[model samples]
Target chain A: MGLAVILCLITWFVLVNSRKMAPLPVSPTSAMVLVPPPTLTPLPTPTIYVSPTPTQRPGLPPASGGIQVGGYVQITGTSGAGLRLRSGAGLEFDPKFLGMDSEVFEVKEGPVEANGITWWYLVAPYDESRSGWAASNYLQIVTTQP
Target chain B: MDIRPAEITANRANSIVTIQWNDGHRSAYPFGLLRAACPCASCRGGHENMSAEPDAEVFSTVLPESPATRIRSVEAAGSYAIIIEWEDGHHYGIYNWHYLRALCPCEECRSRFGEAV
Candidate 1:
């Protein structure tokens, strides 16, 4: 019985230790056989997000009963006008108007009533000229302040 | 830099402020709004903590006393900025280039403005 027990224990030890032993070596010919893994390494690529260009804000809206115009005083037609303050009230161009040709102008301080309707008096100056006032029905109001 | 006449032809759309460089390079700057904000020392210096005042009051107050404003031309300082000679003869401010470039009013900027662009 002891002898039988010794044999059984030897078998158990072999079975457990066998798995831990060195792996069986393959033949040279068998080793040459190629096998590829199922998974693949993917290449990395960069992604870029292109943004769009922005549009310019349109000139200010025309006041009621009048239109704003802009352009060089010497340039004919509305295209040359930067922001014109044309009035149906028969307003005439006066030297009192601060700006000359090629000058930027803005509406400052008024929508005062004249003759019976609200009018906008523009404060503008020549490129090199100091700020001054000009009369207009067409006021180009800037949406943003300076 | 090769200074040349600006290519401001009748066919070309006129911009609010057109800058032509000495090298014959031209850029159109819209005057209405600035995306990067004004680089007037007041806008840049105070808010960025680069200067003492949190506002630009000090710089503006000194404008009336500047001599550069006597000149009519805007002198380009570098690829980035210009020296604005105010009508009052001030030349104390240096407008940086990025500030001007960011002011482009193209369709992209407008859309952004409409939706926090």
Candidate 2:
């Protein structure tokens, strides 16, 4: 009888525990609600980045080149974009006068050597005009100093 | 280094300023040019945008006559710069010798000192 009673009690305990609706005990540190595992998103990464010109060569290149001093010349290499007229020779000169396209100028003096590029000194062909230095690579010779 | 102006004459009627450099070069600037190339913090869009030379766009702009474009007076700011007072009560742009020389808009200066990219 005693053994039977013990078996019945053990069965009752198992049934009651299985039927319980309470959640598992949580510690204060783990009171946060359980979250599903997150899905990772991919990010884009660039493979190459090349600079158009060197950035470390401090200072500007001096004005250089332009044999047809005092001659008429046409602004070229504007490539549908405006050509920069610098205050001095070199790509890094300072404060541009304007970005003009196909503008004509009278060569003055130059053929200076700066930053491995040839430049020319030019004057405004007209009385109400501007004078400055420009890259020879962008200039097309129209005539000798006239 | 001898780029100092031997003489500076302001023609109020003509609204022009004639600067005769010691080297014998004469530059005549219109009052509009001065207003366009003003080096003041407000005129240049702020102090951080300030440069040793004028902006290339200054050549393309046509500033209309007004108190802002009218020169009230021109004062020497030491040997290096000149302080220009405008009739509009704005007198902040200080034109230094180096800056003034570089800002010359003549074709010679334009070609020789094209804006540094």
TM-score per prediction, in order, is 0.29, 0.45
- Candidate 1, residues A1-146, lDDT tens digits: the string is 99999999999999999988988887777747577877955422112111121244232333452233332111111222223344322244333322222233444445455555454444332122323333442223322231
lDDT score at residue B94, model 2, on the 0-100 scale: 93
The TM-score obtained by chain A of candidate 2 when compared with the true chain A? 0.49
Best by lDDT: 2
> Which candidate comes out best when scored by DockQ?
1
Question: Which residue segments of model 1 deviate by more than 4 Å?
Answer: A1-66, A69-146, B1-15, B20-37, B43-71, B110-117
Candidate 1 clash total? 26
Whole-model lDDT for model 1 versus the true structure? Answer: 0.35
- Residue B104's C-alpha lDDT in candidate 2? 63
Clash count list over all predictions: 26, 37
- lDDT tens per residue, model 2, B1-117: 557776776655445566777676656565667788999999999999999988877755556556776677787776667888888999989998778777665445566667432
Candidate 1 interface RMSD to the true structure: 18.4
